[model samples]
Target: MAEQLALRGDEKLLDLGCGNGFIIEELLPHMPAGSFVGLDVAPGILQSARKRLDGADIQAEWVEGSADELGRFQDSSFDRAIALYMMHYVDDIDQALAEAARVLRPGGLFILGTDHPDSLGEMHEVHFKALRQMNDVPSALFKSSPKNRISLTNGQEQLQRHFRNVRTHAWKDELLFPSTGAFLDFYQSHNHCSASSIPGLDLGEGFFEELRCRVGHQVNQIITQKGHFKVTKHTGLIICD
Candidate 1:
């Protein structure tokens, strides 16, 4: 995505949802003469971002804020902006886009990176089926929610509302887990695997443990046959002017 931005080392840049400042760290050298602003709602994450930029000769500022409102910045304050892997967390995406358009200079570039809705593909299908065999998965899981959804079509349409010459790029990769237990631990930590979220389901006490055991067994079977449990990771980016 840094390549797509075509940074010339002098454009004012904004990184919306700049978690831990990792992207900035990677792009810092490319834009040595450019200034940067990192905006995020979490202060803890911003603190980590500051540490990442510490001792660098880059001109940068970290702001604690949300994308839906970037009032602290003046109109056309930025020459480029990026939103990476964090749009799903936003409730009012339209408002956020408007804010981006407001802050960006005319013809400025906006690059957004997010998961393709088909991410994890059959891996999640098999996982969900395993959950249903033991007990009902939450009805909410099937319902559309920004927190757990993305679509290339929807993403392009949204970007078009505020940008021109919108184009999409796809990225694919593979994630391998040596053991089912390891995969289970990672998923449970980042996703809604807790039984507490599905109380009305028929699952009884120790529901999470049972669900974990069954799903782990299913994944382990695949690992035994394939040597490792692999997940297809599908991600995409939208670049607009």
Candidate 2:
């Protein structure tokens, strides 16, 4: 992702939904003379980002705002803009993209990092299977990944509306969890073993506990048989200009 940005050591950059400044910390070194603006809706997240890059010798601004509304920035105010792994949460994808385009200079790049709908197929397979066995699983639990709204599969068509050229760079990789505990930690931390799909399901704490137990049993079986449980990641970047 840092390489795709093609930073020139001096460029005004905007990071939409810049969580914890992870991406900024990595790419800031390459742009010593450049300035950055990190915008997010969460004040707590913005604070974390500020602390993460506290002592850095660079120009950085943190704003609490939504991606769909960029009135804080003037037109052509940025040389580069990025929306990484957070577009699905935007209330309006088109509005956010349009705002990104409005802020970037002519010929500037907008790098969108997102996943394939089936990116974590292995995890979802086990997760859904376990949900199916449960007595009263919410039907919404089986719905597709939220990323499907603007994933590598359909990002080009959406980006084409605002950019003259849209290019997709894709890659695949796998994560091998050697233990059921390790995989369970990952599963629980992310999407709560798919329980997050139905935000309003109102299932109590006991419900998640049982769901985790079932999912863990299946993952343990896979690890026992294959020495490791594998998770495939299908992800890509849609670079626009």
Candidate 3:
């Protein structure tokens, strides 16, 4: 991401949906003479980001605002803009992109980090199989990754609406889970095995318990057959200018 930004150490950068400032922290070293504005809708998250960069000797500001509304920043104020892994949560994806384009300088680059629709195919495969085996499951629960809203597959077209040039840099890697517990932890952290994605499902703890057990069983079987259960990550960056 930093390489795509091509920071000259003095450019003003804007990070839309900058969560906890982890990306900002990593990129700050490249922008020693630069300033950053981290914007997000959650005040709690903004506070967390401020705390995370408390001692860093960098010019950084945290703003509590939505990505679609960049009224706080003036036009052509940023040399680089980024919406990393958080564009899927934007209420209005087009508006957010427009706002980003408006705020960026003429030659500014916007890097959007997102995953392919089938990024974690193994995880989804095991999860759907478990859901199918279970009784009385909500159909809405059988949905694709939320990132599909702005994924590598469809992001280029969306970005082309605003930027003259849109390039996709895709790469793949596999995550090997040594045990069922490790895989379960990864699964639960990602929307609780997709249970949390469906609105108003009102499923009880028992449902999640059973779902986890089933998914864990599948992962365990894979681990026993192979040395570990593998989850392929097909993710990429959509760089626009």
Q: For residues 1-241, could you state the per-residue lDDT of candidate 3 as single tens digits?
A: 7887877899999999998999999998899999999998889988999999999999998988999989878999999999998999898999999999999999999999999988888898999999999999887887666788999989999989999999999999999999999999999999775686566778888999999999999999999999899999999999999
Error (Å) of candidate 2 at residue 221 is 0.4
Candidate topping TM-score: 2
lDDT for every model? 0.81, 0.91, 0.90
Which is the better candidate, 2 or 3, if ranked by TM-score?
2
Tens-digit lDDT track for model 2 on 153-176? 888999999998899999999999
Superior by TM-score: candidate 1 or candidate 2: 2
Model 3 Cα shift for residue 15 (angstroms): 0.9
Number of colliding residue pairs in model 1: 0
Weakest ten-residue segment in model 3 by summed lDDT: 191-200
Clashing pairs in 2: none
Q: To one decimal, what is the Cα RMSD in angstroms of model 2 from the true structure?
A: 1.3
- Candidate 1: where is the Cα deviation over 4 Å? 134-138, 141-150, 192-210
Q: Please report the TM-score between candidate 1 and the true structure.
A: 0.86
